[model samples]
Target: MTDEPALDSARKPVPAGTPDADSAAAPWWTRAVVYQVYPRSFADSDGDGVGDLGGIRAKLGYLAELGVDAVWLSPVYPSPQHDNGYDIRDYQDIDPVFGSLAEFDALLAEAHERGIKIVMDLVVNHTSDEHDWFQESRSSRTNPRRDWYWWRPAAADGGPPNGWRSAFSGPAWTLDGATGEYYLHLFARQQPDLNWENAEVRRAVYAMMNWWLDRGVDGFRMDVINFIAKRVELVDGPRPSVDGGSPMGPQIHDYLQEMHREVFAGRGGEHLTVGEMPGVSVSDAVLFTDPARAEVDMIFQFEHVSLDQGEHKFHALPLSLPALKKSLSRWQDGLADTGWNSLYLNNHDQPRLVSRFGNDSEYRYESATLWALVLHLHRGTPYIYQGEEIGMTNVRFDSIDDYRDIESLNHFREAVQEFDRSPAAVLAGVHTMGRDNARTPMQWDASDNAGFTSGTPWIAANPNFPGINTVADRAGERSIFRFYQRLIALRHESPVVALGAFSMLEPEHEQLYAFTRTLGDETLLVVANASDAPLVGPLPVDVTGGDLVLGNYAGADGSGLRPWEARLYRL
Candidate 1:
């Protein structure tokens, strides 16, 4: 909130190309690359259209060879597919769509056997209305479990409790016919927000997490974990929020501290926990991930990704490189002392990085690899979403009927029907910003169905998969997949890459991104030209000669960079 949280008072600024390492305790994940597997689209062993655990298990060898230290799976729990698998019905068992618990156990055992860890998805903020807890809570006014969810009587004139809108659009509070009450849902009406104010709810969530940890899993990637606590007296938002309700609440720390004490206090394995928090700030993230607090290892913040989203996610603008640089640098400096950071560009709910930020058409491979070096070289743990290694592009939907995401559909309807906009114009927005762009089936090979399945796929494979399949890339020595492998290897082999302090070299440059990382006597300079045109820049004048450690362009030498070019130098 203050201009920026002051840097650790004792630390001094290091030179542009110098190493700065403090004697801080480092964890395995700090130096590890995490790959996220969206189970529904990762791979399908059976002939069914949907991907399952067996599919993921079959790909474990591929992931291992990709050089990721851990695999973070999107939720595999039972759900009604309202928001994909985010609306959970049961946390203890595996969803039938994703195979049984035995398959999950098999996947875990095999992953551990390959020296890779498996992290589970933790969706504790809310649950499906079909969940027994919600069913009972909505059954009657005085049911024993009624208080487990947020429920209130309809307004005097018969309406929702307040003006809070659902995250997917429309009213956040849904009317219950039987009980004549309005139940709250930040997401879809089916996903009623659980009352974290209830001690019983917290106990239940912690117990579910313990169950997963006891099952030999590594840890959790908590979904919207910060939205758990609501204002004691639910007040109407001053303005309607796209996703509804307040985020980064004041009591989030208290709830997280209590949850940490109750669940993760005595856990033996060095589990990795990263919360997917959209509305969190750098200062709040510091408290959430501070080592002493033990609430979580890190959090996924949306500042950088949301910079281009004007007003609402559906409305987007051309991304300014300077703005992106500022966002990343702020977090890098803010959490440098007390906490850690999670770096990513693509996820289940976001468009692919290559399409959204980098060039996906002409210089796809170059831009994708450039972005990878930019983020992976940062002072944080980097995550790779499925298909990212092979440079997947955003999807193009022909019609609203082809879209399955609730948020996308709602926005489409409102844009065309309510706002009286042209259907073509609305469709253009959805095509550009919809979550379905990331949800398209993963491109595995050039065979029928892109080798993702023998049968039809639940979602259509990207038409470009033929040129971008994993099989083709893995066979080529100079493919994007191989480049990612080398990047991960560098992070593991060089402690300087993992531990060096981060300082920006050219913060305001439009096409050029340059930064230095320093630890001990080792200093490295990373520069990327995130544009189609060549860029010229000088090497820092600090009497420096350096080795070209890694580069996207062949024989890339000093003084300048080509289009979408990136180079890492060891000084």
Candidate 2:
């Protein structure tokens, strides 16, 4: 602790709206727009209720025409569905529910033929208790694989190992009767945290990753990548987040560096790696992506996404535009020079951006267009969750039992037992902001199961299917799907958006978020109306005659913007 570590400068607070001066080396992630596919809800080949690889394969043509450079597929690995495929039983095998390995290989081949890369989910931090590795590790303390996971003796007070609590609302350590020891799990009991301290564990993970690369995949979307390394001392973390849960251990970074050296370094040109580093600071992130270390190419920062949570759990709070702007700007600037950044508003773990950030009731299309403009035109690689192009909304659940997300159920139980909250109140929160929000079946059309399957869907579809289906949007020239298609095409065609530097024009304004990207002599300006009313602001940087690139509002005839309208100008 005394060394402070060189490159050990003060962690300057990242200002909102500007990229840092030090971020010169971070590659051209700004121009990238990656589409995220949630396999279970994406598409189903057979009449099965679940989506599969064949379904994804059938849609690559749609994605290719959409013009995104990459597709980030959520976990398709073998799992017990404890955390919706995050709890991996096997890293290398395809889940029978999703499809077989041959089908996945076909997806990789097809995506590559279309010049689109693939980023597979890597869940290395923990594995399902059903996984052979974990089964053997937990069998007995004397087993050769016993040290593969974090197993500690009970505390003096008869509590589990430490005061650490799971992210899903329980003690982080679960008791193992056979060994009379408690094993750590930041998530579910089925997902025991891997002991990164074990050289064998690190090697196994690296070997598994190389196997994927050899199979023709382009990169990996590492799940909770930073949590792999635990603090050796195993000290208790700070008091739980307001409703009560301790912070994840601190030593996670040290393990991350080793992971980079052993796994991601040699695959730079052939493959890219993005770490889902949730608890890292900007300066610390530099260490992970620093070219010298080769730990990873970019990281999915959560500062912006987590703002809505406030003092409660992630799904309990409401979206705040001001808070979002602050969070996005900080990360945009903090990693500006030191590392690369991964931008996204909706993912499998969060609610749909349309429902959470914009007016999802009357103006779903307009609002989703606005959210897309704000994130896609920013300084990082934009990621689009499946069904986002057509503006999907949240999944409504009648009871907590109807929900399948472990985290959501855990929170519901916590609210009732700890806060003595009413069941209605818990359900209300879940309705507004649950992980299941983005898990609904993709609305391909108004047909059966929204065209995701001929049979019943595993999860309920949003009731607004008649209006928001992809078929309707594709047929209409002015639909949200078409707007997204144009935006992605324009980004690749315009240097201002693809290679330009980002400069914020209005950072403090409540209703207006404006920025400009300048590449050589070509400059592009993007103005977004983030409110529910009209906003009129002067064009900050002097501009002459300009061509309107894309406008979500009906009145873009040089007039002010309407609510949730986004406009792009080439000056």
- The backbone clash count of each candidate, in order, is 4, 4
Name the best candidate (by TM-score). Answer: 1
TM-score of each: 0.94, 0.91
Residue-level error in angstroms, candidate 2, position 391: 0.7
Candidate whose lDDT is highest: 1
- CA lDDT, candidate 2, residue 439: 90
Worst ten-residue run, lDDT, model 1? 1-10
Residues 1-571 of candidate 2 have per-residue lDDT tens digits of 1112212122222222333423432244445688999999999899789999999999999998888888889999999888889899989899999989998888899899999999899998899999999899888999999999988888777777577778888788899999899998988998999988788988899789778878888788888887776655543443223334223455666666666555545443345678887767787777776654546777886777777775665445655666667777777666655566677888888888888888888778788898788777776667888888988888787878777788888888989998898889889888877888889899999987788898888887777787779899889866888888887877676545554566777677778778876656667788888878877655554445888777787656555678788888888
Candidate 1 C-alpha RMSD relative to the actual structure = 4.7
